[model samples]
Target chain A: MTHQRWFTPWLLVAPAAVWLAVFSLWPSLNTVVLAFTNAKPLGGGRFTGVENFARITDDAQLGDALLNSVIYMVVCVPLLTLLPLLLAVLVQRKLPGISFFRTAFYTPVIASAVVVALIWGWVLEERGLVNGLAQQLGVLSGPLPFLTDRWLLLLSAISLTVWKGLGYYMIIYLSALGNVSRELHEAAFVDGAGPVRRFFNVTVPGVRNTMALVSVLISVSALRVFSELYVLSDGTGGPGGQDMSVVMLIQMYSRGFTGHLGYASALSLLLFAVTIGPMLLLLRLNRKAA
Target chain B: MRKGWLIPVAAAAAVLLLSGCGLGGDGGAGEDVDASGEVKGKVTFQTWALQPKFTDYVQGVIDAFEAAYPGTEVEWLDQPGDGYSDKVLSQAAGGSLPDVVNLPPDFVLPLVQQGMLLDIEGADDKLNADYVTGGIDAYRYTGHNGVYAYPWYLNTDVNYWNTELLAKYGLDPAKLPTTVDELIAQARTMKKESGGEVYLMSRKPELGDLANAGVPIMAEDGKSFVFNTPEAAAVLDKYRAAFAEGLMPRDVLTDKYAGNAELFNSGTVAWTTGGGNYITSLATDNPTLAPKVIPSPAMGTPPLYAQGLSVASGSKNLPTAMALARWVTNAENQAAFAHLVNIFPSTKASANDPFFAQSDGTPSGDAKVIAFTSLAQARMLQPVEVTGAMSDIVKQQISLAISGDASSQEALDAAVEQCDKLIGQ
Candidate 1:
C-alpha cells in the first residue's frame, strides 16, 4: 500500500516535471552553456573563455538600459502594488452598483494591449482627448506633445502601463481584502481607531503577504515591459530608444537577426541573474520583515 | 516603407530569363542528387508581405511552375515584412525554413555569415549574365565567394515633399534644401515662424542622411568609423539641435513609417523620405496631398535588390528549389511583378521595356523615372559580418546625442570604440 501510494503521487507529478524539464529547465541550461561561447557567424561557436562577458564592459548602452529598467520598476511597482490596494478598498465596500465600479476598473485589465494602445495613442496625441481637454480648460497655451516629447512620452507610457495593470492587482488585493476578518475591523473601531487608522492598523497588516507578492509580480512585469513599449513607441523605444526594457534588448540581440547569439546568450544569462536575483532577494526581505 | 530600418529590402535576388534555355543549368549537377537526374518532391517557397495585393499574381506564377514540372510540388508561404529578421533567425534555428525564401540582402547577411545559405553563384553564372552586376554582387559577403541570394527588385529611396506644407511654412517648393543642414535650418525657421504648428522632419535623421552632409559611416578602407572628424560632429550637432528645438517630432524616436505617413498626409510634418512608391500611397490615402507631392532623387548612396529570393542551404531538394527561384525571377514575371508594386526589375530586358520608358507626366510617373535612374549611381551597401550589432551600437549613441545626453563627438567616438570591439578591429 505504501509503495502504491508513492507510485500515484510520483505518476501525478511526472507529467509536470517532464514538462518543466523539457520546456524550462533544458532551455535555461542550454542558455548558460551558450553564454560561454562565441556562438555565431559560421562554424557556430566555440568555448571562448568569457570573451562575451568581457565585451559587456565596453558596451555603451548597458548603463542606460539598466538606468531605464530601474526607472521603469520604480515607476510601475508602487503604482501597481499600492494604488490597487487603495482602489480595492474603495470598491470593496458593500454599496449599490459597486460591482459596476469594480467591473469598470477591471475592464482595462481585460482589454488587449492593442486596444489599450489605440485608445491611449488617440487620447495622448496632440489633438487627442487629453490635450483637447487641456486646451479647452486653458491649462496650457498650445497643444502639447503627449506622444511626441520624449519625457512626456515616457510618462504617457508609464501612465498607460499603470492604468492597464491597476485592475489586475486590485483583484488580487480584493481577494486578500476578503480574507481579513470583520471582527478585526470592529475591534479596531472599539479601540477608537479612525477609518484611516483602522485601514493602516488592520486591513493593511492582514494583506501584507499579498502586497509583497504583487510587488514581485509588478517588478517582473516592469523588467519585461517590451510589448507595451513596442506599441507605445511604434516599436522604437521612445526618445533615446532607451524606453525598451532589458528583455527587449535581449530579444534584439539574441534572435540571431544580428548574428550575435553568443553575446546575446551571455546577456540572456545576465537577464536570468537580474530577474532571479531580485525575486530571491524579495523573498528574503519579506521573510525578514515577517 | 518601413519608418524604421529594421526591414531593409531583401538585397540579393535579381534574376533575368535571357533566353530561358538553361536557367538552373547546374541543378542536377550539384550535391544530394538521387542519381535519377530529376528535381522532385515538395518544395516550399516563402515570400514576404505579398498577401492580398500580390497573392493572385504569385499563385499564377506557382501554377505555371507546377504545370511545367511534373512530379514536383511548390508550396508557397508568406509572412509580413515587420520583424522579418527575427522571424528568419528563429526559423533558421528551428530548421523550418522553406526551400526557396525571399529576403532583403542586408537582412539576410546574418544568415549568410553563418554559412547557412547555399552557394547559388556556383550553380548559375550564365543565367545572371544580363542581370545588374550590382544586383549579383550585393550578396557577395566579405570572406565567402558564394553568392547567397538572387536579386529581385530595387526600392530606391526618394524625398517626398508636401508642397502645400512647404508653402504653409513659407518655404519655396521650387528650391528645396539639398543637404541635411539646409533642411534643418529651413525647418527651424518654419517651425518658429509658424508658431510651432509645423514639424520639419518625421524622424531623427541618422548616418544615412548625414552621409548626404558628407558624413561617411566608415573610413575608405571600410574597416573603422569615419565620423571621427569635426565635420561629423557638426553634422550630428545639427540633428541634435533639431530634436532639442522640437523641429523633429518626439514620435520619430518610436513611430513606424506608417505612423509617419499618417502625420505627413495630415500635413503635420513637411516632408518624409521613402521609396518612390510612396507617391502611390499618397495618391490612395490622401488624394488631396497627392498632387502636392513632389519627389526628389534619393541623395547619398543606394543599393540594388530591395527584395531577393534564394534557395535554402540544406535542402533535400536543391534542384527544385533552384528551379523555383529561376522561374519566379524570369524576365517576364519580374517585369509584371515590378509593374504591380513599382519594384525595379534588375534585368536589362525588364529595365529597357517600353513600360519603364514611358511617362504620363503624373507625379508617380516622374517618381518612377527617378527611382529607375537613382540605381544608376547607387553603390551596393555591402553588409559586413557584424552589420546589425555595429548599427545597434551606433544608433544607441546617436540617439543619446539626439536626446542631448551626449555631444556628437562623444557619441561618434563611442560608436568607433564599440564597433571596433564587435569587429575585433
Candidate 2:
C-alpha cells in the first residue's frame, strides 16, 4: 500500500513534470550548450569555445542595441510605474460608468502588439494625423520626422511601450490598492488631509511594494522589447539599424539564411543576464523592505 | 520519502536529456539515387501560399500527372506564406522535407549548400534543354556546377507610372523616363514643380540598383563582395545628392516608408517598379487608379525573379518526384498556368507563345507584352549569394550614406567589409 501511494503520486505528476523538463528546462540547458557552438539554422555545428561571445565585444550593432535598451528602460520605468498608479486611483471608486472607464483604459493591453505598433506607425508618419494637425495649427513650419529621425523614432517606440503598458500595470495597481486599509484613509480625511496630501502619505506608502514590482517589470520588458521597435521600424531596426533591441538582434539571427542559431542562443543568454540585474535588485530590495 | 520522489525526477531528467540529443542531430545529406527507375510511388508535393485561389488549377495538374503515370500518387501540401522560410529550415533540419518543393532562388541557396536539394541536371540532362537559358542559369549557384531546381515561373520588374499624377505635377506622361539618369532628373523636376507636394521616387538603392549601375556585386569566384568600387560609390553619390535635394521622401530609407507599390496606389509616388502581374493586382487593389497606370520596360537590365520546384535529395520516391517536378514545369503546364496569371512561363517552348506576344490593348495587356519582352533580356540582377543578413547590411549602410551620416565611399566600404565577413562565416 505504501509503495503504491508513492507510485500513484508520481503518476499524477508525470505529465506536468515531463512537460516542464521537455519545454522549459531542456531549452534553457540547450541554449547554454549552444552558446559554445557555431550552430546554423539548418543544423550542422561545432563547438567554437566562446567565439560568439568574443564577437559581441566588437559588434557595433550590439553597442547601439544596448544603448537603445538603456534609453528605453530609463524612460519607461518612471512613466509606466507612476502613470498607471494614477490611472488606477482615478478608476478605483465604485462610481457610475467606472467599469466602462476601467475597460477603456485596459483595452490596449488586450490589443495585439504588432497591430498596435502598426497603428502607431501611421499616426506618427510625416503626413499622418499628428503632423497634419500640428501643421494646420501653425505649430511647426515643416513636418517633424517622427518616424524618420533616429531620436524621434526611438522616442516614438518608447511612447508606444508606455501607452500599451498603462492598462496592464494599472490593473496590478488596482488590486494592490484594494488591500490598502480604508480606515487609515478615513482617519487621514478626518485630520483634514487633502486628496494630494493623503495620496502622498497614505496611498503612496501603501503601494510602495507594488510600485517596486511594477518598476522591475517595466525595466525587464523595456530591455526585452522587440515587436514595437521591429514593427515600427519595419524590421530594418530604424535608420542605420540603431533602434534595435537585444531581443530584435536575437530574432534577426534566428531566421532564414542569415540565421545563426548558436549566435542567437548567445544573444539570448546576454538578454537573460541583462534582465536578471533588475530582477535580482528587486528581490534584494523587497527582502530589505520586509 | 525524499529518495522515492528523487527517483522519478531523476528518471524524467534522463529521458529529457536523451531526447535533446535527437534535437541536435544534423540534417543528413541524402544519398545518391538511381533516378532512372520507373516512375511509380507516392510523392509529397509542397507549394508556398498557392491554395484556395489556385486550388482547382493545381489539383487539375496533379490529376493529369497521376493519370499520365500509372501507379503514381502525389500528396499536396500548401503552406501559408508567413514564416515559410522558418518552416522550410525546420523541415530540412528534421530531414522531413517534401519530395518536391517550391522555392525562390535565394531560398534554395542554403539548402543547396547543405546538399538537401537534388541536382536536377545530373538526374536528367534532357530536362535542361526544355527551360529557357536565363531560367536555367538562375538555379545554378556561383560555386556549384549543377542546377538545383527545375525552372518554373519567371517574372521581371516592369516600371509603372501614374499618368494622372504626372499630369497633375506638370510632368509629361508621354516623355516618361527610361533610364536611371532621366528618372532622377524627372524626380527633381517634379519635386520643384509640385513644391514637394508629390514624389516621383520612393525607393532606396538596393543591390539590384548597384548591379544595374555596372557594379560587380560579387567577385568572379563568388567568394567575396567587391561592390565597394568607384562605380558603386559614384552611383550612391548620385542618389545621395538627389536625397539631399529632397527628390525622394526622407522616410523612404526608414522602415516607416511604405513600399513603392503601396505609395503608387495611393497616388503619392508617380513611378514604381512591379512584376508583370502588378497592374492586374493593382486593378484589384485600387480600381480607380488602374486606368491611369502606364507600363514601361524597366531601366537598365531588368531584374529577373524566378520560382522553381526543387526535388528533395532524400525522397523515397526519387523517380516519381523528379518526374512530377518536370511535368509540372513542362512547357504545356507552364503555359496553362501563365494564361491564368500574367507571370511569364520559364520553358523555352512557351517563350514564343502568341498568348504572351499579343496585347489585348489594355494597360494590363501592355504590361504583359512589355514584361514578356523584358524577360528575354532580364538576368538575375542580384546575385543568389547575397543572403538576408548581407542585404540588411547594405540597406543600413546605403541609408546612412543617403542620409549624409556617412560618405558614399565609406558606406560602401563598410558594407563590403561586413558582407565579406558574413560570407566567410
Count of backbone collisions in candidate 2: 0
Kindly list the per-residue Cα lDDT of model 2 for residues B257-335, writing each as its tens digit: 5567788888889999999999888988999999999999999999999999999988888989999999999999999
Candidate 1 similarity to native, TM-score: 0.85
Model 2 chain B worst lDDT run, 10 consecutive residues:
B17-26
TM (chain A), candidate 2 = 0.94
* Full-model lDDT for every candidate: 0.73, 0.88
Off by over 4 Å in 1: A1-10, A40-43, A74-81, A142-154, A281-290, B1-42, B66-73, B212-215, B218-229, B244-246, B254-260, B302-305, B381-389, B423-425
RMSD per candidate (Å) reads: 9.4, 2.8
Candidate 2 has a TM-score of 0.93
**On residues A52-100, what C-alpha lDDT tens digit does candidate 2 reach at each position?**
8887776778899999999999999999999999999999999999999
Question: Each prediction's DockQ?
Answer: 0.38, 0.50
